[model samples]
Target: MAVHGRTEAQPIDLTQVRAYGDTLNDGAIALSFSLPVPYGDEAKEAARQLVRQMGLHDPQVYHAHDLGEGYTWLLVYAKSPYSVDFTKISVPKVSNHKLSHAAIEDYWHEHGGGEKLRVIGACTGDDAHTVGIDAILNYKGWRGDKGLESYKCFAVKNLGAQVENDRLLAEAAAFGADVILVSQVVTQKDCHRTNLAALVDLAEAEGARGERIFLCGGPRLSHPIALELGFDAGFGPGTVPSDVASYLVQAVVQRRRENAQPI
Candidate 1:
C-alpha cells in the first residue's frame, strides 16, 4: 500500500495484470480491424461474433464503415477474460543509460587515449533508404541531436545505401572499423532479416566476427530480433544519434576492459 497525505492506495497485483479502462480491473479493450464484407447490420453482427470467438465477452460494435470495394472496417469494445503475469516478462536491452550528446563526447575524450572510434555505417542489401543510417552517421543528424560525424571522438564513414554484404565487410576491414552499423528500411518479405543474418554469416566466414561490434537498425527491428539475427544490438524508430553514440562508446570501453586492454 502507498499513502498520499491521509489517503491510501491499494497495491496492484502483478500476477494477474489486465488492461483497465474507465475503472480498475475492468479489462476493457478496444479493437479495430477490416473484413472483406460490405458494411451493414449483418457486418456489425459478424464483427461481434468474431470478437466473441476471440474469447472476449460482451463485444459491442461501435462503428462500421464501407470501403466501396466489398470491404468493411469495424471498431469494437469488449472485456478481455485473460490476464498475464507481468513478473514473467524478460527482454534483452542495450545496457547503456541515456547520455546527452555533450556528456558522451566528454567521456570519450577523457578516456579515449587519443584514438578515435572508427565507425562504418551503411544501408546494406538493396535497401534504398538512407534516412536511418544517416541520422546516426552523418553530421546533420535527425531532430536536434548532432550525429557521430559531428563528434570529435568518432571517425565516421557512411557508405550510403544498397551496399553488398561482402563489400561492407571489406570496407570494415580496410577502415579498421571498431563498429559496423547496418540499416535495413525495406522489410518486405522479411528481406531485412535475411540480409542481416547473411552479413553476420559472411563476417564469421572471414574470421572477422569477433574483431568488431555489429549493430543493425530499422523500423521493423528490435533488440531481441537483432539478437536472434546475430547482431550485437539493434535500434528502432525514434532513436536519436546520441543514443547510438553513447552505446558504442560504452560498449567499446566494456570490451576493452574484458580483454584487459587500456581504454
Candidate 2:
C-alpha cells in the first residue's frame, strides 16, 4: 500500500495495530483467568471455544489442573484480535528511590545510630491476618532476608490483628513512634479502604499525622492509592521485611533533613 507522491512507510504509531497470522506478533498476549469448571478434555475444549467465540483465534489450552474438589484451573494462549490506543491511557505512579538493605544500614550508621527509632505495626479493624505485619516486624525473615528485628536502631512494637485506630494512635503517641506500619488483609466489601481511611483520619485528629511515616501493606494496596489516601508508601504481596525497613529508615532520614532537625 503506497501513498500518492510518497514512498511506502509504516505508521509511526503502531499502538492500535493488530497483526493477523499463524505466528505470534507484537500484538500477541497470553491471558490466564479462573473459571469454575471440571478438569477434563471437555473443559479444555470449552475454554478454547469460549475464547474463539470472543473473537480470539488459535486458542490453545496449555495446561489444566484440578484446583480441588470439583474445581479446575487452566492456562491458555490465544491470538487476541483486538487492539487499543496506548497513548490514550494514563496511570498514577509512586516515585521513590530503590535502595538495597546494605545501603540503608550504611545510611543509618552514618546518620547516627543508638537513637532507638520506634515503629508501631498492626492489622487494624476486625481483620485477623497478622502474616503481613509479622513479615515486616518480627525477628524471623521473609524471602531469605532478615526482618526489622535485626536492625539495632529500631524499636519495633507489633500489635497483632483486629486493632482499633484509636488504640493504634494512642500507642504511637505513648511510644513516641517514628513510623507506623498498618496491614490490611481483608478487602471484602471494600473494608480495607474504609479501615485505612479511618486510621489516617484518626492520626490527623491526634496531631500525629505528619510526625510519623505512615505505611500500609496488603495483597491489593498500591503506592498510588496509598499516596492518595495519605500514606507515605503502600506495599503489596511478595514484599519482604527489608523493603519496608529500607523505606522507613530512608523516610525518617529524609523527613529529618527536610525539617532540618538536629538529631
Candidate 3:
C-alpha cells in the first residue's frame, strides 16, 4: 500500500481480527479439557455438541483418552467467529516497572543507609504451593535474576509453604521485617482473596501495616486486587524476582524520604 508516494503495509482492523490457524482470520482454536463421562463414541459426541452449544463451529474431537475413574480427556478443535477491538482492551499493571536492581540498591544506600532490611515471605494459609514464593525469594532465583535472598541489601527469610497467618505475623515481627511478602496459589472458592485479607487484618491488628510494606504475589494476583486487600503491592505470573526487588526498594526509599525531617 502507498500513501503520498510513501509505502506502508495496511494495518489490521483491531475490531475484526480473529485467531488464525492456516490463514489470517481463520478463527481456528484448539481446546483441551476433561469430561467426567467415560471415554467412548458417545463421550466424543458429547464434547462436540458441548462445543457447538458454546457458539464454536465445526467442533472436531481430534483425540480422546481414558483418564480412569470415569473421566475422559479430550482435545477439541474448533473455529470461533468472535472478535474484539484489541486496541480497546486494557490490563492493569505496575506503573513503576522499569527500575533496575542496581538502581534500587543505590537508592537504599543513599536514602536509608541502614543495615540489610529484613524481608519475610511464604505461602500463607492452607495453600501449599511454594513455586511462586520460592522463585522470588530463593537464592536460585527465577530464570536469571537473583532472588531477594541473594540481595546484599536484604536479609531474606522464606518460611517455605503452608504457613499459618499468625505464625507468619509472629516471625515477621520477631525479625523486625521491613517487608512482608506473601504468595497464594490455591484459589478454590476465592480462598486466595480470603487468605490475603486475613493477613492484612492481622497486620492491621498488630499495627504493623504502617511499619512494613505488605506485598502479595501469585499466579492469580494483580495490583488492583492486592491494593483492595490492603497490600502495598501485588504481583502476578511471569514477574521476575528483580522486578519485585526493584519495586520494594523504590517504595521503601520513598517512604523513608517522606519521613525525613526538614533542614
Q: Who wins the lDDT comparison?
A: 1
Q: lDDT tens string, model 3, 1-263?
A: 55533246545578787886665666889999999999899999999999999999999999999999999999999999999888788876665656677776776676656777789999989998998999999988998888988878889999998999999999998998989999999999999999999988987998777878899999999998998999988999898998898888777766666766321
| Top TM-score prediction, candidate number | 1
The CA lDDT of each predicted structure is 0.90, 0.81, 0.86
Error of 3 at 173 (Å): 2.7
Candidate 1 wrongly placed segments (more than 4 Å): 1-11, 100-103, 110-113, 257-263
Could you give candidate 2's per-residue lDDT for residues 93-188 as a string of tens digits?
Answer: 434565677876777777744587789999999999998889888888787877888787688899999999999999988998989999998999
Listing every candidate in turn, what is its Cα RMSD in Å to the true structure after a full C-alpha superposition? 3.7, 6.9, 4.6
The order by descending TM-score is 1, 3, 2
**TM accuracy, model 2:** 0.70
lDDT of 1 at 230: 93
Candidate 1: tens digits of C-alpha lDDT, residues 1-263: 32321124656779998886666577889999998988899889999999999999999988999987989999999999789999999999998987888888888887777799999999999899998999988898989988999998899999998999999999999998989999999999999999999999999999999878999999999999999999999999998999999999888877777777877
Instruction: Order the candidates by lDDT, highest first.
Output: 1, 3, 2
Error of 3 at 103 (Å): 2.2
